[model samples]
Target: AIEHDYHDDAPYYMLLAWFKRVPRSSDKVMLLTHGLMNINRWDLAQELQSIKDDKRSEQGTFSKD
Candidate 1:
């Protein structure tokens, strides 16, 4: 199971991503259960960067007044 404790006072997100005994998954290989909890940190970084850019744009516009 993949558990991410993002905050100390907030509920964590848990995702069952693996098998206990490496069960025979050949027939069920089509399942995308694995990597289901894979968090792409870069995606969030890009979002934060976008927000910063927007703030800068707003600041520039106000500075021109």
Candidate 2:
């Protein structure tokens, strides 16, 4: 499970549930993009870049302004 606090007073959660899943050894990727008007951070960009560089993964999130 992955959790992000978003550094806000009101807490929010995004839950991903999978049932009867099959694993594969391929470069299948899912990207999530979020728009933020009040927040700005480049850390997410670096994280995503690192993941892509590794070339072995699935499922990720990238939040941006």
Candidate 3:
């Protein structure tokens, strides 16, 4: 799970972008962490966006669904 500050407005997509680049973690863990981050941000749209981005990345594209 992620520790978050609701007052912070840093773009959620940025975190997902970085998550995809880390070399040592499993996809499941990355997704789980992303989930927690979005939950903490109270941004369902960002959560969905992250999942779509992950799928696109797995398919060799980094665009939207």
Candidate 4:
């Protein structure tokens, strides 16, 4: 669906599609991470998870401020 809609820009447009369709940022991250893992891209998935963790930590700190 995203590839069909984006054509040549699917890679970049996927994020837009996710945000438009998924509602939450964490769910967006999970969707992308799981998709990558399904394709055996474990390294990328782990990296994304790390980034998500970092962002959550940052949000937690900011909320305490």
Candidates 1 and 3: which is better by lDDT?
3
- Locate the minimum summed-lDDT window of 10 residues in model 3: 1-10
Q: CA lDDT of each candidate?
A: 0.48, 0.37, 0.63, 0.86
The candidate that achieves the highest TM-score relative to the unseen native structure: 4
Error of 3 at 3 (Å): 37
For residues 1-65, write the lDDT of model 4, one tens digit per residue: 88577687866777777678875546778888999999999999999999999999999999999
lDDT, residue 40, candidate 4: 100
Task: Write down the TM-score for model 2.
Answer: 0.28
RMSD of each: 15.1, 12.5, 9.3, 5.1
Itemize residue pairs with steric clashes in candidate 1: none
Quick one: best lDDT, which candidate? 4
What TM value does model 4 have?
A: 0.66
| Cα-based lDDT at residue 31, candidate 3 | 64
Q: TM-score-based ranking, best first?
A: 4, 1, 3, 2
